[model samples]
Every structure is written in structure tokens, then in C-alpha cells.
Target chain A: MADEVILLDFPLSAFGMRVRIALAEKGVKYEYREEADFMKRIKSDLLLKMNPVHKKIPVLIHNGKPVCESLIIVQYIDEVWKDKSPWLPSDPYQRAQARFWTDFADKKIYGDSRSVWSTKGEEREAFLENFKVLEAELGDKPFFVSDTFGFADIALVTFYGWFYSIKTFGQFSIEAECPTIVAWAKRCMQRESIARTLPD
Target chain B: MADEVILLDFPLSAFGMRVRIALAEKGVKYEYREEADFMKRIKSDLLLKMNPVHKKIPVLIHNGKPVCESLIIVQYIDEVWKDKSPWLPSDPYQRAQARFWTDFADKKIYGDSRSVWSTKGEEREAFLENFKVLEAELGDKPFFVSDTFGFADIALVTFYGWFYSIKTFGQFSIEAECPTIVAWAKRCMQRESIARTLPD
Candidate 1:
């Protein structure tokens, strides 16, 4: 039986972009439905029915069932389509490490980005300090998990698409602070999967 | 060769209790190091060294390595000790569902509990409204994922220990709001693994 996959998403959401990159990586075909009225507080009934719990986007509906949460959907994609490219490491500890950093990106990076754009003075400085911590973690590694464009890479590189807007709103230069991370992100962008899915 | 496992945790923490319960469920023996001075703003060197990223509790140190984050640790325990008992379902979709609710518990439940305890009037009312959403999800299911007391159950039921304090602080009866959820929590409490690990 042929698989039917549909993604309920918004174009600007980094979370939604993560799923797109993952699907593209494994060469999976999926219908992408952009939630145009998402910002206006109007959500489609299809989205609401598919994700009753959160009523949010990036819901992957596969054969009528829905998977909510971006990271969970990415993991589901990796598990169901393990043939071509593996998003996570095979070893248990390595897998745990991958999850930990991906989770870090989810919890910390996005929040820090928001704060960087919305706050000022000492508050924005504090958020910049947090951003530096992420920079230090990236350090010399080509990718977050060291030499593999896997889960953490997918989790974080989506933010590269939004760096312009974040820097504009915050009045800061990401390249000035974290050149290595920028270089790494540029490398990830070279991939057809990431290049195609990420918004300009 | 014997396996050496250690859990660095705090007794009062519901997150820490989660790791304890999973370890007990798997019948794995491990050293439990209570972080008595955690509230005093004093973190042990081992805790910092093991989890440099978060520098938080519920770190499962297996052999010499550490796995941070409660859900991640619980998943790790399940993966490593697959022979004894499984914390997560084997099916891909079911596992995704379990993870979604578990993530909900992690993101929503703790913050809602804090608001329930620390606020009053409309602020508290707003949190109570959020709490009801969780109650609604529980519905008639024996567990978050049907009949099985799996990942989502473990993620949530640990907070049952704090319900007394929350109810007292908020001046409300959880039983009145959601009897089914309370009943399910009671069912989980009957397990020796949960009974022994959860605090009063």
C-alpha cells in the first residue's frame, strides 16, 4: 500500500521547517498545506481535528492518524523510513545525546531568539549571553553531534532561515559572535534537502 | 562484570521521582544521591561535571556517562533494559503519541502546578482552566495511552505527590474537578515502584 503523508504547517515556523527538512532528507513525498490564516488566529478544521490536543501546526497526518509535536514527528519519520538516511545515531547513548541537544534547541534556542528580538538593555544582554553558550557548544564541531547531519543538526539549522529577521529585530550580528556556527550552517545549507525546504 | 548506575536527584522533585520510578520498574539497582543542598544554590561538582549543559537534577549516570532530562533518561532506561520491562510502546505511532503527552506533561503540567500554588484570583483561575484541559484529555482512559501505564503516565503521575500541596495552596479539590484522573493516579500509586519512590 502506498503511504499518504500530509503536513499541516506554517511557512515561517522553524518547527514546521524541521519536519520539511527531515522529509526531504529521506526523499519522502508529502503534501504541505500552509496555514495562511495562522497568524490571524484562524485555524483550519482539518488542523484542529488532526491535532485536538495542541491545535497547532506541524501535524503529520499519515494514513488518517496525526502526529503532533515537531521533534516527535521528526523521530517518527526517522523510525518509519530508516532505509535511506538515519537522522539519529544507532547507539543508545549517542541517541540520548542527540535527543538532549535537540531538546536543548527546542527549549533554549527559540526562547533565547524571542528574547533577543523582543527585549532591550540588560535583559537582551542576558539573552545574548545565553546565545553565546550555544555558540560555545557548537565550538569546532561541523555539526552538533560531530560530523553527522543528524537530529540535532536538523533541529537547529532551521533557525538559520530566520537569522536575518532575528538579527534585524535584535540589532546584532550572528556572524560576528559565532563564525564557526555560521560556517557549519552554511555547510548544512549546501544540502538539497535543507536548501529546498528552508525559507529565504 | 557488574553494572554501576547512579541517580543524582532531589527527593522533593517530581522530575527526579520519575527516574526513580522507571529504574524501579526495570528492577535495576542503582545508587541514589540526594541533592539536599540544591535549594541552597549549591550544586555538587559531580552534578555540574556530568551535566554541564543544564546542570540540573535527575541525571542518570550509567557506568561513567550521564543522561540528562527526565523523559530522555526514562527512554534511555527503556532502551538499555529492554528485556525486563518497556516504558515506551514498540509501535512507531503509539510511541509518538506517548512522547506527545509526555512532552505536554513536561511543558504544561509543572508550570500549571506552580501557578496553582503561587497565584490567586484571575491569575490562578487562568491556570485552573489550563488544568481542566489535562483532565479532559484523561477522560475515561485508564492511562494517558489507553490501558497501559507507560511513558505519559510516569511523566504525569509523579506530580500526584504534589497535588496535596497544590490543592491546599490553591484552596480547591482536585477530586471535584477530575475524579477519573485522580482514580487513574491512585491506580498508578498502587504499583510498588511508584509507591516506594514518590514522596509524601
Candidate 2:
């Protein structure tokens, strides 16, 4: 049986972009269903049915089963299509560390810019400390978990789309605040998968 | 070299209980370091150095390295000790579903009672809807994700210790509000690992 993969998402969603990048990384072809009224705070019935609990977008329907939450969806993609470049590390300890950083970004840094922009409408302040911490973690490494641009990279780099809006509203450049992070993200972008999916 | 395992935790932490339960389930022997001043929000130098990023308790030190965050720590435990009773399910799709529910409890349900109790002093309300959703998901199954008491059960059952306090502050019994959830918790407690680790 052919695999039926459908992604219910609107464009310009940082979370959705994570899935796209992951799918692109895996070279997994999926049906894309854009939620037309998502920006207006109206959910498509398919989205509501797919993610009844969160009622959020970026639901990855693989063979009719829905995987909600952006990071979870990415992990699902990684696990399902393991024949390609791996997102998670092979070592147990390294995998835990990879998950830790990804989870950290999801909890702390990911939503702040979006919420600040959408709610206050140009009133903003950058949480530069989080970025600085990220920079320190990256150090001289080519990627977050070393040479490979893997799980943590996918999680944080997707937010690069909103960095422009963040700089515009907050009046602070991510390049200036965390040069190392920007460098890492730019390195990630050089990959056609991330470069293609990440919004301008 | 023999494995040197150590757990840095203060008893009475729901998150700490989760680590303890996971360790017990795997029958892995480890040194338990009690953080006496955790209730005062004071960190020992060990906990500080071990989990420099979060500076939170419940750091699982396997060998010489540290793994922080409860769910991350639990996953670490699950991965490192794959010989025993598995916390996560085997199939990729089932694993995603397990992670989804656990993530829901972590984000929505886990910290509410603690913050509410600590700050407002008995001014509280049970987010019974979340519990009802959980109960509906449980259905007639002996455990979440069918038969085997695993990931989601570990995540939620740790909170059973706080159910009494939630009832007192919110003035609603979980037994009444969500009997199936309570019953499931009780059933999980019958397991020696959970029964031993969970605090009253």
C-alpha cells in the first residue's frame, strides 16, 4: 500500500516549516493542505478533526494517523523515514542532549517573537539572553549537536523566518545579538532543504 | 568499568518521582542524593554544576555526565536501560502518540497545582476538562496505549501524589470528576516500581 501523508498547515507558520524541512530532509513526499482561515483564528474542520485537542495546525497525517505538535511531528518524520539523514543521534546520551536543546527552544525561545509581534503589534523586546546561551552552546561547532545539522538545528533554525519581523519590531538584530547563532543558522540554510522551506 | 549512576533529587517533587519510578522499573541501582534545601529553592553545588542550563533538581547522572529535565531524564533512562520494562512503546506511530499525550500533560496539567498552591494559597480550580479528555482516551483499557502501563502513565501517575492537594484547594475530588483517570492511577500504583516511588 502506498503511504498517504498529508500536512494541514498555513504558510508562514514556523512550526509547520519544521515539518517541511524535516520532510524535505527525508525526501518524503506528502500532500500539503493549507488552512485558509488559520490567520483569522478560524480552523479548518480537517485540522480540528486531525488535532482535536490543540486545534492547531501543522498536523502530519501519515497513512491517516495525525501527529500533532511541531517537534513531535518532526521526530515522527525522523523515525518513519530513517533511511535518510538522521535527525536524532545514534547514542542514547547524545539523543537525550539533542532532545533537551530542542525541547528548550520549543518551551522558551520559539513562541516569544510570534506572540510579541501578533499581540502588541510592533511593541517588542528581544530575549537576547536565550540567544546568547544558544551561542555559547554552539561555540565553534559547525552545528548545534556538532557537525551534523540535525534535530536541534531544525527546531531553532525554522524560527529564522520570524527573525526579520523580530528585528523590525524589537529593533535589535539577531546577527548582532548572537552572531554565532546566525552563523549556525546560515550554515543550516545552505542545505537546500532548509533553505528552500524557510520563509524569507 | 561498572556504571556509576546517581540521581540528584528532592523527595516530594512530582518530576523527581518520575525519575525514581523509571529507575526502579528498569531495576537499575543508583545512588540517590537528596537535595535538602530544594523546598527553599536553594540549589546545591552538585545540582548547579550538573544541570548548569536549567539549574533545576532531578538531574540524572549516568556515569560522569548529567541529563536534565524530567521527561528528558525519563527518556534517557528508557534508552540507556532497554533491557527491562520499557517506558516508551516500540512502534514509531505508537511512540509518537505516547509522546503527544505526555507532552500535553507536561504543558497544560503538570505545573498548575504547584504554582496555584505556592502563590495563591487554596485559590484554585481543577482543569477537569483535561482530565476528562484523558479519561475518554483511556476508555476501557487497563492503561493508556493499551494493556502495558508505559510512557503516558509514567507522566500522569506521578501527579497522583498531588491529586489530594488539588482536591483540597479546588474543592473537587478527581474520583468524582474523573473516576476513570483516578482508577487508572490506582491500577498503575499496583506496579512495584510506581508503588514504591510515588509519595503520599
- lDDT of every model, 2 decimals: 0.84, 0.83
Return the TM-score for each candidate structure. 0.93, 0.93
Query: Taking the tens digit of each residue's C-alpha lDDT, what string does model 1 give over A52-108?
Result: 777898899999899999999999999899897687777889889889889888888
Relative to the true structure, candidate 1 reaches a TM of 0.93
Where is model 2 more than 4 Å wrong at Cα?
Answer: A36-38, A114-126, B36-38, B114-126
Instruction: Please report how far candidate 1 places residue B153 from its true position, in Å.
Output: 1.2
Worst 10 residues of 1 chain B by lDDT: B111-120
Cα error, candidate 2, residue B39 (Å): 3.2
Candidate 2 lDDT over B1-200, as tens digits, reads 98999999998888998899999988889999985465587789989899877788899998899999999999998888988868777789898989998998897677454454544434434366677788899999998874798888888898888788766875567788788888898999889988988875
User: Alpha carbon lDDT of residue B127, candidate 2?
Assistant: 60
Q: Where does candidate 2 chain B have its weakest 10-residue lDDT segment?
A: B117-126
Candidate 1: give the clashing pairs: none
Model 1 agreement with the true structure over B1-200: per-residue lDDT tens digits: 88899999988788899999999999999999975355687788888898887889989999998999998999899889889757677789988988888988877777566677654677677666655777887888888875778999999898788678767767776777767778988999899999998875
Model 2 reaches what TM-score against the true structure? Answer: 0.93
